[model samples]
Target: MTTGVERLFDELGHFNRFQACLYFAAIFQAISCGIHYLASVFLVETPTFLCDGPSNITHVLYKNHSSSSLEEIWTHYKPGDGPVVVQTSKGDQWELSPCSKALRLNVINFQYDFFGNKTMESCGSFLYDHSEVEQSIVTDWDLVCEKEWLAKLTQPTFMLGVLIGALVFGDAADRIGRRPILMATSLCQFIFGVTAAFTENYYLFVVMRFLLAMVSSGYLVVVFVYVTEFTGIKVRTWTSMHVHAAFAVGIMVVALVGYLVRVWWIYQIILTLSTSPFLLYCWKFPETPFYLMAKGQYKEAQELLDTMAYFNSLPSTLKVSQLKDENDRALLKDTKKHLETEKRLSILDMFGSLKMAGRSATCWAIWFIGSLGYYVFSLGSVNLGGNQYINLFLAGAVEIPSYLIGCFAMDRVGRKKTCAPALLLAGVACILIIVLPQDNDLLAIFLSMTGKFAIAIAFGLIYLYTCELYPTIIRSLAVGSGSMMCRVGSVVAPFCVYLADIWIYLPQLIVGILAFIIGILTMLLPETLGEPLTSTLEEAEALGSKPYTKNAAVDRLEMKQSIKA
Candidate 1:
């Protein structure tokens, strides 16, 4: 049956100017999340570097060529093909070994070692190719060679913070309200993001990045639930999917900004500053009526509904007397219920029964696999043998059509069919890469992009499908738990990419097998295509096996009787 708030939504007109304003306002948060999530690709990129030569070589060159350019003088010691023959200021050509310096011998008589062994020693410092990225954490903190593990740890650490944020903010929103969490997270994202840019210490930078990611995840979860509650069923799928489309746009923006601003700190500043407009949500946004009604705050729910009706230019069928009557009845019912049961709803409640447990497990597995494949392809895209910026931009660009296709498929074919096939297809695409010729960079990129395309579809579908699968009371908690699992997959994604060193095809092979298995598991989930958003646990548990009717006639009859009374 439709809840009181949902019935009011039907009368007030779904997808009106009020809902439109809120939907667009929430898009900025999604964009900010996209930028922050993938900004590390450029922020920590490893540039082409080599061991700097010995100090004696530098001193000798400086003494001989007093006014010579650094590039001209360093050419004698830098790596190159054969020995470089340089014409000195005296108009004499001298042969210089690129990798070695002769002791107690003339510079002209130095011979280059081309074949087997040379006396190689540990580098005191390193030289980097700064054509692409002028500076990054790798260059600034020397997170290369022996210290490379620290560079790899940055992303997983950020994801860990995101995981914790999902748990904290998810439960808090359910208990307190979505509005406060949403506002607070938005403000904190800005604060931590900008603060991360200014920290000179690498560990301090990582700490700030972790905090920023935490708030970003919280903001994303609350905004999704808040918008989902306000939207009607007819347009919910597209609106939710569009939020991710906005996310893809943010990824593309990162590529653009990363290309234009090669300095890492400056890029961070710009990305965080762009999201400052979203802080206005505190002043403009309203608390969702579904949450109010679920909490038995009928008067507050009715007032919000009246405001919605006024903004949408519709007649308000609810009256103060009707709200008071319902409130009184609800108070008495709650008084009796509280005496009977003291248990509260939580993420654990989703697994309270065997059937619900089975469904929740399937949802969790799907989330895990989806996140793993999505991020594995995302982080590996930059290394796919082309311009990193262009490749990253294409990675985000391909997702737009994927989300559109997912929206169409889920709307027409149902959520199960859409997500399952997409996962299977992504698996097939990734696994096929194992057989490609080693030198075929173009074909390898094509298969990788194909995997990204299919996984993007599945990734987008899971958010909308999970929202529809759970009831309103525990909806944010369920999504948050699912997202927490998603972060677990993301936390492991960097290691998955690192697996390429063990075996060339290892990463894709792993991703493929996992996706294939989860694709089959996804079929066990209930189809939530056209169902009303269930308001209670009993209604949610009956989703797949039971057939529900909106019963417009009965709802109108009840509204008339309540108005008359």
Candidate 2:
């Protein structure tokens, strides 16, 4: 009795309906990825009324001899009629003209002046400086909890979870199987996600988030490996690009939802809980033919391959044993090595005598720098304007084209050609945003969006490029470590957001320069387009062999005529 997935794969080629479903489901799971920095839109940065209380406001009204009170101005006069009623760091409130609002709120220009003089807020035309505003409003550490700065400790906590999942789960996939581990990760994702949503204290939320992050990484690593392994040499390139593009799409979707939803925890609930059901569907999913073979489950692997061939109506030659490829054999050998070794595999194993260590390490560095800049740029969108949502969406929307263009070019021009230029352009773009006038701001916003476009491509290309360089055995470990570097980057990205308080444009400029340096460093890496996805240590040691030209690959693919054709 062939399983439903087996019957389906019998019709399709190497892809059964179940595996196809998992692929799409996994991509959609990208939505739950940590976009907290962008999604923090509503929880903070909200505006308040200036005449919020009864003291000087009433006195000022009486002194004016007007029946109209300050409260009336707040009700009747919005920011256009007068300055927006914004709460200062202090408990005090103020009514100033819109021009004065900018001047007063220009913490970069004015914070020092107020600090030296002991006053931060100016009282109307006369300067009644309330300098204690920083101490008062910035209650994140104090009001939230004095040691709350430790909340930033979230990244490392999250990283610890990620580190555990990548090493543990990667090894487990060999013994326990890919589909089961993925299913388990998904359930864990749901549990931790729902748990994190309800935490009472900030620390609890952080801890739950850390756990969720680990769960999330497991699914991602498995999905990336599963999808790429089943993909043909021709489609693998584009499929890899799409996986990462899905992540960017996830970020964009979260930003839009945050804009509409406008609450922090609510956004988490949306991200985490909303996707749990897909995991249910995933429970019924089938294993990858490539993965099953790697585990020495040869019979099961053949059944899957034959089933896939039947479903896709591929040439009958694709049946069972016939589906074998050179890469598939290599994958089996690597799995055997991992199994024979003690449960622990050191990071050094990735480099061991491979002479590929230098290349892999550099790839991780690019991963770190790329992620750091991308998220820093993203998180900083808030200060770009209070309308961070629109800016973020626009920045994100631009990635669709960036993804397409990058996938199209990465193989044609080689990884080096595409990656270095993308990073360099992104850096130049950041510098462009910095030079644009900040306050007379439409042009500024436009230029910043342009910069976003550059970084978006840079982000997409890094993952695709990294996949090609390292072999399959440590692909997840290498990529996960790279992704871990990204989380490290995300951790540091918030601190860059902190920089926005002093000189709003400075963080952009600094992140841009960092991006440029990454591009420069990328020149050191070999172009892996037309290269093999190595299956084990020995092949990786030699630097995976270049396999086919992008054009030749494309021609071969076109000749095959896919469904999209």
Candidate 3:
């Protein structure tokens, strides 16, 4: 009997196909970006702000807690007044504000013993449970808008989650299979997102946000890995570029929704919860063919290749035995001895031999700064000082044309030259925005638009460029590491916005300068537009074979040889 994979491969033949499969980023980012995390950032709590105060009492400690039954807890009489005196077991007396304005009017006081466990018992809000009471405290305050220092507290940490996720999740993807991780994250994302939406306690919300961000890490890296593996080399670059552009599209899409749905928390619920469908459906998509090959699931890989061949309307070749799943077993079984001999992969491997530490460092710096500046400008869509969604939509619109131009020019002029100037000029555009008067709306918009345009171009070029620079063996790892660097920029992006409130443009200027320096440094690298992908770092450096060095005479001569093969 034919196996399941073989049958699946037969059915896949009817689908549209290219030299390689193209899983557009538009499919991922547009769906994922709607999270309130991307849109309404205002709900994030600030922990530093002092809440227990005389005037602030009117704002409600918990909310709607009127208690006449606290008479037993009171010693210094207050039949109707808001303030009362309560006596402690140690014979000390203190004047305390009544729970009249608090949401939990029936709250019972509790004390802890030396080991720091709850020792004394108390009854709180007879009508409400502990969860409800905690919820009351959560919903009761607007710490940041109220100028509470605690509000500033949450902002710093919100970013830390993104950073930690970027690093930790890279390992997570490696240790666990992609399917399990992606599915687990999707379930957790939905749960945490819901918890975050309704959570009344500030700390609880913060915890959820961190969890949400942490799971988000592998999502980015995995999507690229998936798309890159499934696609043919001819269309891979353009498709990868589309994935990031999908993120931008997501930003714009969510910004518009955020504009319409002004209730920040409600918006968060919508963004996070809405994408559940996409993730659920994504579960059905096939695993990466290369990942299968590596795992030694050669049969699966063969079946997948047949599916692709069917999709492309090409005849399927090879027997079922030949189509083993490389991944389902040992990826480098033959090389295991060599790996054991070396015991480790070195950073020096990136240089191939000459120790191109300077070049590697410089490239990483460009990757980092390009990430930073790109975010500063792209996310600055929130700062457009008008309809945020409209500005975001318009900013996003600029990319379609810019990408089309890039897709057109990159293959023509080549990679490094085109990418470098785009980055450097993006920096200049950022600086221009600072000097341009905020009141000169037209010039400001123009300069800002130019900055965004450059960022989009630079961002697109980086993905394709990094992939080209690294050879196939370490291609995924190199790109993923560079992506991890982008998370550093992402973590800081929020803090920069916070600082913008104190000194507008200061952050942008810092970001711009960094981008310029790195962009110029990127020019130090070599170009590889038409060359066959080098399979190892050593081959990458040797740089044999000029690409497409076709003479009409040689092409005509090759036509005769083609008949012999």
Q: Identify the candidate with maximal lDDT.
A: 1
Would you estimate the TM-scores of all the predictions? 0.80, 0.70, 0.69
- lDDT by residue (1-565, candidate 1, tens digit) is 3334444556666699889888888877778988898889888888756554333232223323432323454433434444333333443333334223322222443233233333334555666667667899888887877778888888888888878887788779989998889888888989999999999988999999999888888887777778777887557667767787788888888988998998899999999988788886565678887677668776787788889888898888766455445444544544553344335567788898887898899888888888888888888887777677888888889999998888888889999999999999989988888887867877878898899999989888887688778765566667768877888898998788878767867889999998888898888888887776664577778898897754453333222222111
Ranking by lDDT: 1, 2, 3
Where does the lowest 10-residue lDDT sum fall in candidate 1? 556-565
**Which prediction has the highest TM-score against the true structure?**
1
lDDT of 1 at 536: 59
Write the residue-wise lDDT of candidate 3 on 22-73 in tens digits: 4642246334632433543434322122112232221111112332233222
Q: On TM-score, who's better, 1 or 2?
A: 1
Residue 236's C-alpha lDDT in candidate 3?
50
Q: Which residue window of length 10 is worst by lDDT in model 3?
A: 556-565
Model 2 TM-score, 2 decimals: 0.70
- Local error of candidate 2 at 179, Å? 1.7
lDDT of candidate 1 at residue 227, scale 0 to 100 = 77
Candidate 3, superposed: residue stretches over 4 Å from native: 1-26, 34-37, 40-140, 145-156, 167-169, 302-320, 323-344, 348-355, 470-480, 535-565
Q: How many residue pairs clash in each candidate?
A: 0, 25, 35
Ranking by TM-score: 1, 2, 3
